[model samples]
Target: MEWAPVCAEGETYANKCMADAAGAQIEYEGECENYFTKEQAQIAAKKWLEEESPTFKFDGIPGSIKYIGYESYTCFGCFGFTFTFNSSHAGYGNRSGQMLAQAIANHTILVQTRGKNVSYALTDGAFDELRQIFICPAISALIPVCGTDNITYPHPCPAMQAGVKIAYEGECQ
Candidate 1:
């Protein structure tokens, strides 16, 4: 059965009719953003990673992939997702020993629809306000850090990329 949420109270009903009976205005489709889980985040990232790999040339092998952290933003008919992950393939290359070991980077993907077409993309620079939104640069040192938000960032760069303040030298407590 399809479910609907009374967003104001964070309540979910079996269906829209049940929600309407409760005199609650339907917020939107599916679960609220806070309900999104780490597993779902990894699934979204993996799906897009597969679909965009040909164009993006991602070299990470399947078993070597690990998700560090993610953030999702939703509005009206559009959504944006940002994730930081590591792959044994090492996203950045520097011809040095450690540099060739692993790669940590942030990737942002967006969803938007116009008419009947739905697009999942790295960025939509078409809009003036979104010009600054971009995939973080592919280069990063292997320095992992904890952000003030209590999330572990692969490195300070990705934490900065997400605008999260660095809290310390290692994983969050």
Candidate 2:
């Protein structure tokens, strides 16, 4: 007789070892719910970010929000979600977590307002010229820096050369 491992959810595994590795209870065979889809998780992540923003606090500032990207994972008896985001203003970098939606939301709001709080107005034509000059090199170097104007630069040098003071050392987004 050929023996196969049956998990608690009645999912057949290649063998007992495989089932155990998956964290499936061998004795309680039944049905398992479907795993969360990427799109669904993304939506949930966005909603979580929005809902959790009210309580998010950073650097003694309130109502700040950060940008976030979501990814989904499947574990033995549960589904897992993770967020990728930047938190440099309060002083940090690309970070990930299963429960970082609030942090990301706060940081994003901070970055968005980083430029607005300051008063530095530039003409559309001048801004366009500066963008043309520095955007390409910054893109090639892969250095994302934010300017005092709240505009994100491809690199710090570009922002400096353009006479735009560097506000932060990472992408605003």
The residue-level lDDT of candidate 2 at 112 comes to: 13
Model 1 over residues 20-118: C-alpha lDDT tens digits?
778866665555444334354455545655444322234434543343344434432233444333334533212233324344433333433221223
Give the C-alpha lDDT of model 1: 0.46
**Global lDDT scores for all candidate models:** 0.46, 0.40
Best-performing candidate as measured by TM-score: 1
TM-score of model 2 vs. true structure: 0.24
Quote the positional error of residue 169 for candidate 2 in Å. 25
Runs in model 2 deviating more than 4 A are 1-28, 53-68, 71-173
